[model samples]
Target chain A: METKMVISNLLHRPTRTIISILAVAIEVGLVMLTVGMTTGMLSETARRVEGIGADIIVQPPGASFLMGFTPAPMPIKIGDLLEEKVEHVAHVLPVLILMNVGVGVNIVFGINREQFDAVTGGFVFHSGGWFTGPDDIIVDDLYAKAGHLKVGQKLTLFSHSFRITGIVEHGKGARLFIPLQTDEELNQTQDKASIFFVKCTDPGYTDDAISGIRQFLPTYPVRSMAEYTSLYSSNNLPALNTFIEALICIALTIGFLVIFLSMYTTITERTREIGILKSLGASKSYIMSLILREAATICVLGIAAGEVGTLGARRVLQSSFPTLAVRLTPHWMVYAAVLAMGGTVLGAVYPALRAASLDPVDALAYE
Target chain B: MEPIILTSDLKKIYRIGKVEVPALRGVDLVVPEGEFVAVAGPSGCGKSTLLHVLGGLTAPTSGKVLVDGNDFSAMNDADRTRFRRHKIGFVFQRFNLLPTLTARNNIAIAQHIQGNGFNPHRFQAIVEMLGIQGKLNHRPYALSGGEQQRVAIARAVICEPKILLADEPTGNLDSENSQIVLNMLRGLNRSFRQTILMITHNPDAAALADRVLRMRDGRMLLD
Candidate 1:
């Protein structure tokens, strides 16, 4: 009976089609925003863990200073500071990675792996083996993504000219590593070690090691792997999360209300008819199911619309944030869709029950 | 044959704030299978009330209503509705065709609601027989008063219910359309052996029935 009425009503009025579309679109947009932000955070986190050049980052005092490009270059002497003072700081490989990147002064890190692994087991040279010799600079893929460099592309910085040998991606922050000898020669800092990475007997020693290093080097800073990643993430995001969350909440609230009211009015309009149906032998469940059938129809349409709206919204919003660390993964898409559909069902509960529980006698006589 | 419909000492009293207006008072009735019986009375009589009680659309305060030998009072509301769906048809004063549906679909839904599959040939025949061949696809709002009445009749008769209760079926129609609707009803009564219980104020419309039931003050004065 409900099936017949649902199909009949859909075909008859069909204006409800427009309403369903609009409702679903709003719902989907909300979900997309939520899942999109969630996804962005997840992707950025993954990227941060997937460090770029140095398998391990060596910085002064804190991760922020390393990520910040404002470093207090280590004192006394570059090689002597680590070689003479610290224990378990076995190999003191000195390399200059932090500097102003392009003509616009973007932060950058250049590595020299032969000198790098002499102290810490950090980054692996993925494609072209570690900067085995001088002038071999493996630039981070951001330069390519930023349309700054390609293979064989020459980047002339403050003191050195580099021919990009390979493009590399870092799991952690946005820094590049070249050969240490070349970096040191360019910076002309024979007496300076901006920072040093030390290999300990255990990964658990990381906290103690950082604390221990900070004690002797009072003015400097130190941080662990996770902390380092979080610093980059917090620095890059904050606003994206806050904006999307607010927009999604508002859209969902307004959309659900619209759908709820639309359904309510439909029930109100058909109150008398429902009574007639009840009189015609429809059970409470049967009547309820009949009305809920409309809700179901609306949900199906709404979910589809919301998904499309989300996609459209994502595309439109992408241009506003250039370094949007989120990847639009399919898993995130499915999650958003489920949210859109589930929200519609949740929103439909009150109206469906209200229409269902109506007394057939009263309903029939209702004007 | 046992009476298909039997009501024993049925009563309906509507309470308005403090006063109780008795609509039906211990009314006993028996309508046999395929019998054409007219219940006649002036306005306010219990003819309409009687029809509603017999059809199980309204429950009497006391007594028994049996349709096809089953006790209506004994069954629950759901069971009573099931009985109404399978055994009865109604044609209202306003010719209550659902305004949204086409004439054909309106008739078709009654059958579908009763779980009967569509038989186009039977539908086509019924529409043609009712002289609504040209207006099958027209909605109630699009059709004239007369045409809408015929469509209502078409819906009622198409289900081929055992008893058809028509409450002033031609009250809203003109004389010409009245004749058309009445003739179509009478044709259904004779050809299909339908048992019709129709109430009307129009003498001309009532005159067409095998029996005319006039109602007044919620009770029938004559039969």
Candidate 2:
């Protein structure tokens, strides 16, 4: 019966209820969406590292800043130095990347098939097997599909007609990695590869190998997968995270203010009624529930609206930027609901108690 | 018969910075089970304060209150609320029914607060007795002043508390409605043998109560 009264009271004043709930919902949704987005990107970077099959990542000094990027040149040649001095390194393959390519730009990697398998297990063919000929090469799925090229189709890539022997998924870097011999011939330069990954025979030797790489190529920055992942997450989505946090703080503040005033007004209006309830042996907890329950109902319903709004926003953004998705996870939704409900309950504490503790004599006297 | 309520030298004081104002001063009182008594006073004459102290709505400045042989002064706020809920019922001036609820829902809410489901028969009987059967589904705002007061009365009594405390139950009604509400109260007193202590300024309403006690300046003139 007490719960019913609370619900009825909230429904009685629809305008006030909506505004308060909106405040709470927006705050909760912002927190959920921001944390989820940053966390997702971080996890994405980790998954990428794991896909490469190397427990340890070795990069030159400040190499993370140059990932998928081109620079003038490092003072040291990483691929050559690892081959010369790193003893525990089983086999090292140099991988080069050029990020944010224009349309139809072909990315090049210099690797030997034997050395490449030291990390990745090579492509699992969707149709054709691994590349077996010099004239044969793997074409990127994006370019292959766009130009209507298929296996055995000789496609023009970087002024070279290379037969599509197989297609490699972007899991290994999404770039084309021809043999070191072909790479040197095509690029027509003897320039050393920018970055080379060291594969250790024993997983325990990964740290030693990273330290050795640092000692051998001290002029280059060395970044492990851990540091790389953290750097990538901070760089890529820092703005989104900050915006989400700020928006949530503002929303919750607004929500609390709205709830505070609304509940105060509601308690004031029900002065006589509350006095009567007190007279009837209703406890303070019962009275508190009456007000807080109304707040809760508003919170749950507002969060429902926010969930739908966020879902729609995510779908639209996902379509625009295909690689990314706004995952409205169950965990995020739970977090949002908790924040909304908790904020509303806390906001309602003062007014509800004040109303419950009203002196019957005075309340009855209020006009 | 042993009295169901007793108060000895009950006093209530309100403190404002440097001043302490007495709302009730040195009063001894008693009401037996099944007796219908009225406390009559003008505004601020301490009638409401007297009722509140007895109901455990506020603590007395100096004295003790015993309701059904339990010392209300000794109970904590939560304990007092529980004691008040099951042991006492209250009716207020202005027909203080929850405005959003239908008449039937208003009556049911009291028992609901007790954590028990509605007693359909008891509700139906209260509705029939109060002559508000047609207004059961009407919100308090949709009902007449008289009808609202009757709903308020039904809400109070539906819990079946041992004592019913009414502070101006007919204050909002006209003579015709007031007489009708008083008649219903008389019927409740006879049928259930309810112990009713009413606070009112109207002598006619006070007359309906078996005994009338007048108050002036925070002191009970007659009991």
Candidate 3:
């Protein structure tokens, strides 16, 4: 019965209820969307790193683990240096990283043709064959589907049109691939590659190989494939924790202010009603409970709307940016809901206190 | 029988920007159990203040108000509030029914606040006495002025408190509706032997009570 009163009171003013609910929903949806995008990118980067079939990765020191496209180049001679200096070295492949400006935020991996094929397990090509020329590029199925490109179609990057020589399955490598020399010539970087991929002759000795390479190039960062993938998971994404903390603050503030203003004005409008309740033998605690219950009911309904809104938003984003993965896990939704509800309850405290403290005589006399 | 409510030297002062305005000035009063008493006065004679203090909605500046021989003046805010919920009920001039609630729930809430859930038998009796049984589901806006007042009276008596404090119960009613509402109150008082303290400016309204007291300028006048 008390719940019924709360619901009736909130529904009494449709416009006010809608505005407050929308405020909460929008804040929660934004938190979910932004956080989902960040985690999704982190997961995608980790997956791509593991797909290259390399046992170890050697990059410049201090390179961001999740920043797959960062131009942190090292000498291409590091490939040979590893093969000569490390005992377990089987093959070392150098990869140049280039940014694809024409087609969204994508990384282009430039590799030596022979070493790339040998180390990449040779692509399970869906159409066409390997890139036979310097100006040719190969794409995976995901990129082809996202960009509506196929074999024999030309893709324009850096104002240069290159024919798509092949389309392979995704999870094999980065979406776009080019010749190492072609990338170096186009980007004005001669004899430089972003990082080196090292394979050990004995699979069981990869850990030792990584340690040996680290010693040979102490200034460079070296990690086994498993370690590298784990490094790029959501927990290790640089600045991701800080970004979520800032978002939580923003979401909580929005929830608090909207609910506070709503409940404050609502209590003010119902001052006479509160007076009547008091005169009808209502205790101060009774009045407080009434106000708090109403506020909590609003919060619950708002959170429900926010949860549904987030699901709808995820679908729309996936359709709009097919290549952009959005990880809207159940855990994230629950966290957002709890945070929103907590903020709303806190917001209602002052208004509930004010209502409970009203002087019955003065409030009853209010016009 | 002992007086169910007693007040001696009851005074309430209002502060208006450093000015002390006395709303109740050393008023002494007594009402025995089962008595229906009316306090008649002009506006600003502090009748409402006296009613508020008697109901424990407001505290007196000095002296004592004992309801059921328990000192209300000595009780703290929380205790006074609890006392009011269990021991007193109120009806106002404006018929202060919650507009958002149905007439039935309005009455039921009185019992709900008394820390007891609704009693179906008691609720039915009050609604029948007030002739508001069929109108229980209607909101306040849908009820007539007389119906609204009767619902208010029913709400006040639903908890069966020791005293019912009414401030101008029929002030917002037409002459016909006023008589009907007064009749309901008289019927309830006679049937249940309920104690009532009513504040009113109408002579006819006062005439319905078992005893009448008149006040002017915050002091009881000889009637």
Clash statistics: count for each candidate? 50, 9, 0
* Overall lDDT per candidate, in order of appearance: 0.65, 0.73, 0.86
Give me the displacement of residue A145 in model 2, in angstroms: 14
Highest DockQ, which number?
3
Q: Score the docking of each candidate (DockQ).
A: 0.28, 0.54, 0.81
Docking quality (DockQ) of candidate 1? 0.28
Look at candidate 2 and tell me the lDDT of residue B35: 89
Q: Model 2 chain B, TM?
A: 0.97
Top TM-score model: 3
Candidate 1, CAPRI quality class derived from DockQ: acceptable
**Better model by DockQ, 1 or 2?**
2
Report the C-alpha lDDT of model 3 over A1-367, residue by residue, as the tens digit.
Answer: 6777888898898899889988888778877887888888778767877887988888887776644555568888889888888989988888888877665788888888777765667687899988889899999887888888889999888887899999988775588898888999887888887878888898799988988987889888898888888876556644778888898799889999999999999999999999888887677778888888987877778888888988888788777766787788889888888888888889999999999999988889878
Fnat for model 1 comes to 0.33
**B1: Cα error in model 3, Å:** 2.7
Q: Report the error of model 2 at residue B112, Å.
A: 2.4
Off by over 4 Å in 1: A1-4, A11-17, A48-51, A57-172, A175-255, A275-280, A357-367, B15-21, B38-46
- What are the C-alpha RMSDs, in order, of all predicted structures? 7.4, 6.5, 2.1
lDDT assessment of candidate 2: 0.73
Give lDDT: candidate 2, residue A277: 69
